[model samples]
Every structure is written in C-alpha cells, then in structure tokens.
Target: MSAIASSTRVLVIGGGPAGATASTLLARNGFDVTLIEKEIFPRYHIGETLLVSVQPIINLLGAREKADAMQFQKKAGVLWQWGGEEWTFDWTKLNCDFTSSFHVKRERFDEMLLRHAQSQGVKVHEGVSISEIHFKGDRPVSADWHEEGSGEAGRIEFDYLIDTSGRAGIMANKYLKSRRFLKAFQNVAVWAYWKGGKRPETGFEGPLTLVSVPDGWIWYIPIEEDVHSVGLVCHSEAFKESKTKESVEELYQRNLAASPLIADLLKPADKVSAMYVERDYSYSSDRLAGPGYFLSGDAGCFIDPLLSSGVHLAMHSGTMAAACLASVMRGEVSEERATRFYHKCYRAHFVRWAVMVSTFYDVNNKKETAFWRAQTLSKEDLQGAEWTDLKPAFSTLMSGLIDMRDAQDSDLLSQTKSRLDTVLQQIRDNHPAPNDRFYRNGEEKFDWGRRPENAIDGLYCTYEPKLGLVDTGPTERAFAAVESSPAAE
Candidate 1:
C-alpha cells in the first residue's frame, strides 16, 4: 500500500447534527475519523425540535443522560390551526413508538453531540472549509481546505468521505438538477429565540401549537427552560406588493400584528437577537452518493419545516450513512453494495416526506385566495420532477423494507378504503360514533354535526385510516428503479 493510503482516514465535512452523528458512530465502530466544520461551536441553527427516535441514538452514544440534564422542553406532538380552529394530536400516534419528543437549544444540543463524538476518539476541527476535492482510484485521495478564522491552508487524504454540510456545501451539488416544486411553498421564516413564551410541561399531552393563517403559519417551538423558538412562515405573495424595506424586526412585528395569537405572545416578550429570515422552504437532490463519498441530512435533501422534521431526518440519515459506509470499510460488503445501501436509505427517507409536502398544499378548504388554491389544486405548480421518482422509493420504506427514512406509500384510494373499514371497526369497539363534532370556523361559523372525534378528523380520516399505510408492489418497483438507475449501487 502507498504511504498516503496508510495515513488515509475517514474525513467528515460539516459538524452539525448529521456530521457529528456520523463521525461519532464511525469512531465508535473503530475507524479513524476526522470531522472538519466551517462554523465554530455553539452556532445558531433553525431546527430546534427533535423526534423520539433521537433518544435511542443519544443513548447509543452515551449522551442521553447529558442531554436529559440540559435545559430543554419535551413535546407530546404538534398542534395545528386550521379552518380557524385548533387541534392537538400525539406524535406517538404515528408509527414511531415514542411517548414524547424534546425541544432543545441548538447551542447546547449540538455541543453535546460533538463532545460525545470527540470522546469516542473522533478528531474534530472547527472553523475549516473545504476548497476542493481530489478523487483518485475508487475513493477521495485528498481534500484542500482552509481554517476560517486564521485562513490557514491544509490538505488531507481519506479512505472515505462523508458530507453532512447541510445546505451550505451540497456535496451532491454537481449531480444536483434543478428540482422545482409542483406548487412552490414560497414562504419565508423569520425566527429568533425568546426568554419567555409558552412551554408545555415535559411529557405533556399537547404539542407546540401552530397558528395557521390565510397567507402562512406560525410555529412555537419551546427549547431549554423558559426559552421558546418562535417563528412565522408566511406566503411570498403577501410581500410582493409591500413597498417597505423594513428591518427583520419590523417585519416580524408586522407579521405578529397580523395574528392575534402571536401578538398576544410577543406583547411582553423581548427578542434576544436580531430577527433573521429564510426563504425557499422546499428543494430536492436525487443523487446523494457518488463513488467513495456519501451525503446525509440537508446535504442529501430537505423538505418543508412545517413538520419540524429537519433535525430528525438529519440525525437519522447520518446514522444510516455511517452504518452503510462502515459496512464497506469493514470488508463486510463491496463498495458497490454500500453505494446501493446509501441510495436506498436516502431515497426511502425523503420521498414520502416530499409527497406529504405535496399533500399539504393540495387542501382546498380553509384556504383563502389564489396562492393557497394554486398551491394545492394545480399540478402545473409542481416544481421538481426528480422527486416524482421518489414516490416509489418512499413507498418501499413505508412497507418496512427500509428504516432509514420514515415514509408510507399507500395510494389515496387504498388508504381511504382501509380507513373507512378501520373507523367502522373502531366505532364498534368503542361504542361511540367514530367521530362526534363537525364544524368549520371562518368569517362565519358553520356547524356540520356533533360527535366526540376531533374537528380535523371529521374532514380527514384519523390515523388508522389516513396517510400512513405501506404499499407492497409499487414500492418495490420504485426501489428497483432506484437501485437499477445509474444513481444507485
């Protein structure tokens, strides 16, 4: 072996949740890993929510105790506002089996993950950016990078490269095609942390609520004790005619004024930092792995943050990528096989999420104006075609074929049929009408009927009959196409 090959190690780019998780997992598996990140420790990031699946991974890395002790808030599920009414449901109602999840401050949560990685023998360096990459043989031979604060240049060769750089340095950018949404969400988020806001008790029965408006929605995520991650996601059309170039703070206040709930919450709270805005909520990248390198988290793809799924998907993908790469490094599998594993894992994860995003805009009722109408009903608004291929890939994951991505693939017709039957059965078992109350609130209030079921369930079927079912055939075909496609292992 060449001297360069002897010195070669695993190089991980980006130090966020995905990079840190992947690096730590690899190191624990006994690989020599080096994680280089562009930002310094404890930087601010938008996604402060975590899913129940996160706990096991944290426990695996021996950071669960530390994470539990950190200043954070636990969430039961998400509460949504629709049709001028509010409803709350448990996230545990979904397929995953966790009683609750947590909201965390990124500063402490990220530091905890990185420290765990470092303690596991992973070498970590911050404030470094990759300038170029050289691929020789079947793997990356070297990468040239510079330290951020000092601007010092250096290079390193690695046996394998893992890119978890989130959206900044898309490792798959060269292979990325322009993925347009059928109906663009065209919403921007203005977010900042505050010391005082509503926080649900740890292991409570309610979700952090989202107050939905005609033009957009507001998310209230509670982080460490007494600190809430608050933000507004509003439609782009609303800002088109506005002539003022207001500061972020002004815009936030204006948005708050537009909503009574937000106005009430912000009335006494003080902003801790300058308000920041992020537009373009949706995008997709199909080819997430090439040759010896693999992509995870936002580096692979991202969907709308409406579900607060960013951090959950990132951490999950990082774990799967690390496992697949480690399999190859251990001679347990061929590199070609590993590549296939990576593609399957990444696709299975993102495709269902993409479809759910599509479904959100498709709703016609409770929607006011052309923006909301166009987003849901029109097929022309669909932006990215590469994601269409994801439909089948998503189905496979839902069928229990893959666990990397949490997607379900049943067709609307099949789901409705299943739900109808399930609802009837549940009614029989419970001795109550499947649902009790049906009403719509708007400029005028309309009452449809009465029952015990939640209002949202009256229009949409509950969990047993709604969106989360796994299909068998279409899913396999999707997986086969992805596996047989040039993009696969």
Candidate 2:
C-alpha cells in the first residue's frame, strides 16, 4: 500500500461534469478533495448543450457571470422535431428564466468548469491515470495511480471514493454494475464539430434543434461562434447499411445527404473535429453507490440524449453524490444508508426520462416506412409503469402537446395517460409479470411541473420508480412523502 492513510476525505476519479461538480461542491464545504483526470483541459467533448434546469446549479457555482462574459450561445428552449411535428418549449417557462439554456463549446466549457473547481480550492491532478481500484468490500480505501507516459506506479488511500468517471467506470462498472441496456434506445451516434458551419439568423438562434427523419433523428447544436456540434443519431440498423470502407469524414457527408435538413446545414460547413461513432450508447446502471463508494453523472447512468438529458442528469447526480458523501463524513448517516438514499435519488429522475425517450420508437404514430414503424411499434413491450405514467405526459408536453404541422388537437395529458394506463392494466392483468425490476407501484406520482426535492429522485426515479409517473396533484403528494422521509435506512 503506497502512502496508506487511516482515511481519505474523498477521492474522485474522472474530471468531467460529475467529477468536477462534485469536487467543487465538496471543496466549497471545506473538505479535502482530490480530483483526477486522464485527459488534459481544453479537450474536445461531444455533449455541448445544456438544459434550462442547469441554471440553478450554474448559479450555485457562481459561473453565470463568467459564462455570459464568454459569449456562450444562449437558447430559449429546445425545438424538437419528432413524430412528424416540430414543437418548441421555452424552458424559461419552467422557472429557469434567469439564464438561457446554453450551446457550449465543450473545450471551453469543460475547461471553465475544471478551472472553476480549482479556484474553489479543489486539488486537481491532470494527465494521471487511476489504473485500478483496490478496496476491502465497498470501502475503496486505496487506488493505484500512474502517470500516463511513464511506468511508475503509486497509490493513495482515502476514506470515501466518488466515481464520476462517466460512462461505465469504477463504482458503476465494477461495484454497482448499474449499466442497463434499455432496448428502446438501440442507436449509434457519429459526432464531430465543424467550423464555419451554418449559423441561423439572429432571434432564430437556439442551442438544440432536433431534426427527425423516418428511422432516427439528427441533433444540430451550435456552439461558440461559427463552430457547430453536429451528430447523426440513427437506429443501429440504419447506420450499418450506410457503413463503408470510406473514412468517417466521407461517411459523414454521405449520411448527411440522407436527410435534406442536415444536408442543407453541412453544405457550407467544414469538419473541425474527428468523427467518432459510438454504438449501443444508451445504458442505465444497476445502482449508484454502496458503502464508501458512490457514482455520479455519466458514471451512474446516461439516458438517451434525445432530450439533452445528458448534462442535466450528470449535474444532478454530482450534486446528489456530494450531499450523500457529506452525510457520511458528518456521521449523520451510515455508509449503507447513504448509498441506499443515493440510489433512490438517482433512479427517480432517470426513469421518467427513459420512458419518455422510448415513446419515439413507437411506430403506431403513423410514420411512413418499415424502419420507423419497427422502431416505434417495437416499444410496445415497454409498457411498465414508468413507461405508462411518466412517458406519455413528458412526451406530450415535450413534443409541443401537438404536432405543429396541423390543428388536430388532442388532450396530450389524457391521451397519454389513457394509453399508458391501458398498458399498465394489461401488464397487471397478465398471468405472470415480466419482472419486478421493470415494474413499480402504480400509486406513486411525479410532478414534472416542478423540480423534486433531491436531484436524484427529481431526475432519475431510481428509488420509487412510480415517482416518474404523472405530474400533478398525486405526484406532489408523493414527492412530499419521499422528501420528508429520513434518509433511507
């Protein structure tokens, strides 16, 4: 054991949003935190868009003024083009009016966050790799560390460990194994940044634009000035057919030609970053944490990015993990209790988002083509309570409550619930339920109209899966009960 100490204040791996945010928060609280990152700052990252909900967290970190000074892209809200409709919602209408949603240049944004954390007294180590985690049970007291370019090995022991490693890392992969492959979101995304890309006219500027075609959708996000983040997220099958021996750049051009909307945008743009494609990119986790180890951000889970839930969920988890770790440090709760509480919080928010995303795969909405049809109808088996209650309402509202193409009005709330309720009833009416993992108490409620008490519950719905369903009177009551409860036992 290299430099084995009796206890460590907190050891955080990965310097992305979750790791950076957690370290910043904990350091601000006067804790000894060491944050390790393999990649150097100003590195390129794909997810550059943020939701309006992040305003509060940004405000908490006091980054609002600085971000504004940097001239970040301001957004009114998300304009989603899906299910044959183009709908827009001003998230400012959802109480995040102080700041606009952002289209960030990740190179700048991530560097800013890391620098901000350092300014707040966080101990940040860059260009270091944590080779392996060595723990006695769930309390990871030591981690083997090494310099990226050298053969030297070292170790540091800590009392608490936070795995914010983003995407299947440490606590999430080895301990919690929380990553779950939700069949509904079976797609691949090829993303690259382009300089001198199309910029919309003033007042028409938006951070996120969803251009939906038959098989899948393409996300067009403009970041910084003249540099836009473009990615094509398509069903796996659609992607394979277009695969060729050509370079990613060539494939990018060919793929863009598949959709006129994307083609028009790329006509004048030049690729600024290498094109990378990630398959089976959608996943959830088995749990968020246990004992001395906790998972945060993408380390815990990542729902489909269709709604741009990526950054928001990661930020939410980072905040939640920091609080849980603090509780353990203060002796206010046992490590086991803290883990359970964190897990509950993690699931509450994500479950709702997952269900909502799955609805896009529902082919029954009358799209033209077998590919779109199979993608949508394939989601029929997704009729669990989380799918029924929360998805319909979320999708209905997120999709503008009605397709912008025509005036055929439908009560999005009632229609969604009726369809969801029918599915729930059918599952309940069946002889043998598929599995309890996919099911939750139908009695619970969720108030999407308002943010929930804790970031985890408010974001994932991992604890009371029912909390992801329905936003209104019942959800309000349900949220109160869960919030009032003493941290999970």
Candidate 3:
C-alpha cells in the first residue's frame, strides 16, 4: 500500500467542477491531493445556466472575482413559460447576497476551476486516463493511470478515492456498480449556441428563460458578446419519435419551426455551433461513500438541468466531501461518522432534487403528447415520492435551500420549516401565490404584476400515496436537533 504515515493522500479522478472543487478544498486544507483529467482544459460542456445556491461555493473557492473578471452575464433569476403563461423566479425574493449568479461559458469556467485548484497546491494533471483501481472491501487502495501519447504510466496509493468524473461516474460505476437512474428524469436535450439573437434590452438583460414548446421545453440563456445559449429538452419518447423520421438536426428544425415564439426571437440570429444532443442523462449512485472511497459532484448524482442545479450540486457535494473528509483527518469525527454524515448529506440533497425535478416534468401545459406524458409524472408518481404533508409546493427548492452544507444549521432548518409552512399556506389560500416575477411576452413591455397561479399540487405535488404525506417537517427538526447538539453524535 502506498499509504503515507502522516498525511492523507487523496486521489480525485476527473478535473471537472466536482473533482476540481474537491481537490482544491482538500489541498487547501493541507491534504496531499492529486487530480487527473482525461481531457485537457478549455473544453466544451453544456449546463450553462447557474443557480444562486452556487454563490457560496464560488465565494468559498475565491472564484467569484475571477468569474466577475471573465465578464459573463449576471443571471438574476429564471423566467419560465408553461402552457401559455410566462413567469419568473426572482432570486432577490430570497433576500440573500447570492440572489445573483452567472451564466458562464463552460470552456472558460471549467479551465478557471482546474487552474484555481492547481494554485491551491493540488497536483493537477491533464491528458491522463485512469487504467485500474485496486480495492479491498469497498475501500480503494491504489489507482493506475497513463499520460496521453507518452505511454508513461504511474500508480499511486491513496488513503481515500474520490470520483468526480461527471456522468461517466468512473470509479463509482466501474468498481462500485451502484448507479441508479430515476425513471422520471430520463430526458434528452438538443442545443446550440446562437449569435445576434433578440438580446434582452434592459432589466431582464442577463436572465435565463425556460419556454415550453409542443413536445419539449427550450432554454434561452444570454451569454457574452451578443451570444445566446439555446437548447431544447424533449421527452425521451418524443425524441425517439422524432428520430425515427429525420436526422437530429432535421428533427430539431421541425421543432424549432413549431416554436414560433422562440423562432421569432431567434429570427435575426445565426447558429454559431452545430446542434448537439444527449439522452438518458440524469442519474444517481446508490450511496455517496463507503469505507475509504467517496463520490463527489456528478459522480454522486446529476439532476435534470431544468433549474440549473447541475453546477450548484457539483460544487456543494465536492465542497461538502472536502469538509467531511477534513473533519475525519483532523480527528474531529471518526471515519464511520464522516461516511454516515456524507451519505446523509449527499443523498438527501440528491433525492430531494430528484423528487423536485420530477414535479416539473409533470408539465402543466395542458398537452398530453408523448413529450409531456413521458416527461411527466402522474398522481401515483407524486404519492410514490411522498413529498410531504405540508407539500410545500417545493418551489424554493430550485431557489437553493436543499444545497446547504451544514446539515444541522438550526437557523437554516428553522428558516426552511417556516418557509415551507408559508409556501404551503399560500398554495391552499390561493392568494395570488407571489406572481410578482411574472413577465408576459409578445407585449411591448415587461409585466411586473402577479400572474395567474399554476399550481401542480393535486397532480404531482401532493399525491396521497398509501402512506400520508411524509411530513418532512419532523425530519427537518431532527436534523436541526442533531446539528445543534453539543456532541452531534
């Protein structure tokens, strides 16, 4: 075994956000960290929109300034169109500094992360591929990988193994074999970048919008230099249905034409990149960590990118993993305790986001097409998820509550319970339900008034499964109690 006598040697596989963020935090905290990436930086990636929840992570990593330096557009919140009404989820309503985040260019954003991790003393390598991992009883002991083209190979022993290889899941998939895909979020996305689109004129200049179309929804994001990130998420069956008739590009065009609102918006724009399509993308692993191994970021779970939860979760998990492992190394907590805490923290967020995203797929566009039905969940699905007795509408979830790292922050828990109660009451009272963020399109100006309430509760939010609502309030209090306890045991 290559285990050291003094310090913990951590090998983080994958150089994306998760691996980069984890390795960076670990290295900063004095752990010997090595990060390997098969692909070099300045790479292309999707999931361009970001949520406010990621601000803390970005600030923690000291990347907020770097991001600001890059001049990516500042995203205030999300504006979405469902059925025929358009509304916005303003982050400012949360009354926090992170009310604003960025819509980044993935190539630049990723390279910055890896470089920052390197600056923090992580031995980061690019163009390297992992060949094998030797483990003993779920605990990885060593790993082997080779550099690109040189054929030069190296083996490193580790006290811990972290897989942040994104959807590839690297060690989590090949060695552990514990991946599980949620049927509700099985989706396919086809997207491309556009130049010269009808850019937002003023207050809404940099926000992201989700427009519901016939068989899928379109993501219209504003990027730098008059460029826009436009993509469509089609129901898996709808995608296949289109695929059987024409080429992917042709299918996309057919849908694009059908999307007159988006088409009119993009009329003056030019395609800057070829259309790219990815299918069957959302999934999660059985458990985050066991023994001496851990899963971070996309390796742990990837929710549907509808609310731009991808980067936020990756950053949160990576940072949380670092904090948990740091506690173990510092003797503040036992390894078993750390593992349990990590599992609880990681799984709770993933499962919570999974359940929340599933609710969105129950698209209330009044259309029963394959894209809508296949992407949606019925009352049975909601009952199966058991959202809660209060059924809090699960709206603010996309606003970033589930990603908090301190599992036991009493103030956070209290705030969460209070917010859930308030939201639940709003749903029941039907008191305008805070449509202050709604912006009607096809109009001469932005509509600052409250829009009509479009609650998806009976259909997907509060299905009465065999058991009544799970009553997440108690569970929330339980976590709060554990956190506030002196021993936290």
Best by TM-score: 3
Runs in model 3 deviating more than 4 A are 1-8, 200-202, 363-365, 377-489
Worst 10 residues of 2 by lDDT: 463-472
Count of residue pairs whose backbone atoms collide, per candidate? 18, 24, 0
lDDT of 2: 0.62
- Ranking according to lDDT, highest score first: 3, 2, 1
Q: Could you report the Cα RMSD, in angstroms, for every candidate shown? A: 12.1, 7.1, 11.0
Q: Residue 406 of candidate 3: its Cα lDDT?
A: 20
Error of 2 at 257 (Å): 3.3
Candidate ranking (TM-score, best to worst): 3, 2, 1
- Tens digit per residue, CA lDDT, model 2, 1-489: 122233358998988888888888788767898887888887877787887556656665667787677678887665555555454554444322343568887788888888898898878878777878887865678888876765566788888888888875766667555566666667788888778777543244564677766546678888767777888776776667656555556656665677676677778888877777887466667667776787888887777777777887777678767766765676655667668656664664566556545554452357665345544313443322232223221221222222211222334434444554455455446525332222233321223322343232233222121112111123667666645544321
Report the lDDT tens digits of candidate 3 across residue range 1-489. 122122238888899888888888788767899887888888988878887766666666767787677887888766656666655555554444456788998888899889999898888878888879888876888888887767777787888888888888877688878777766667899988899988543354476877777877888898776899888888787788787888888777777777666788799999999888887466777778889878988888887887678888887678767866776676755677667556654665565565445545543435777677665433332222222222222233334443322222344234434444443343435423323221111121111111112122211111111101111123556545533543323
The better-scoring model by TM-score among 1 and 3 is 3
In candidate 1, stretches whose alpha carbon ends up further than 4 angstroms from where it belongs are: 1-7, 91-97, 137-139, 174-183, 199-206, 243-251, 364-366, 374-489
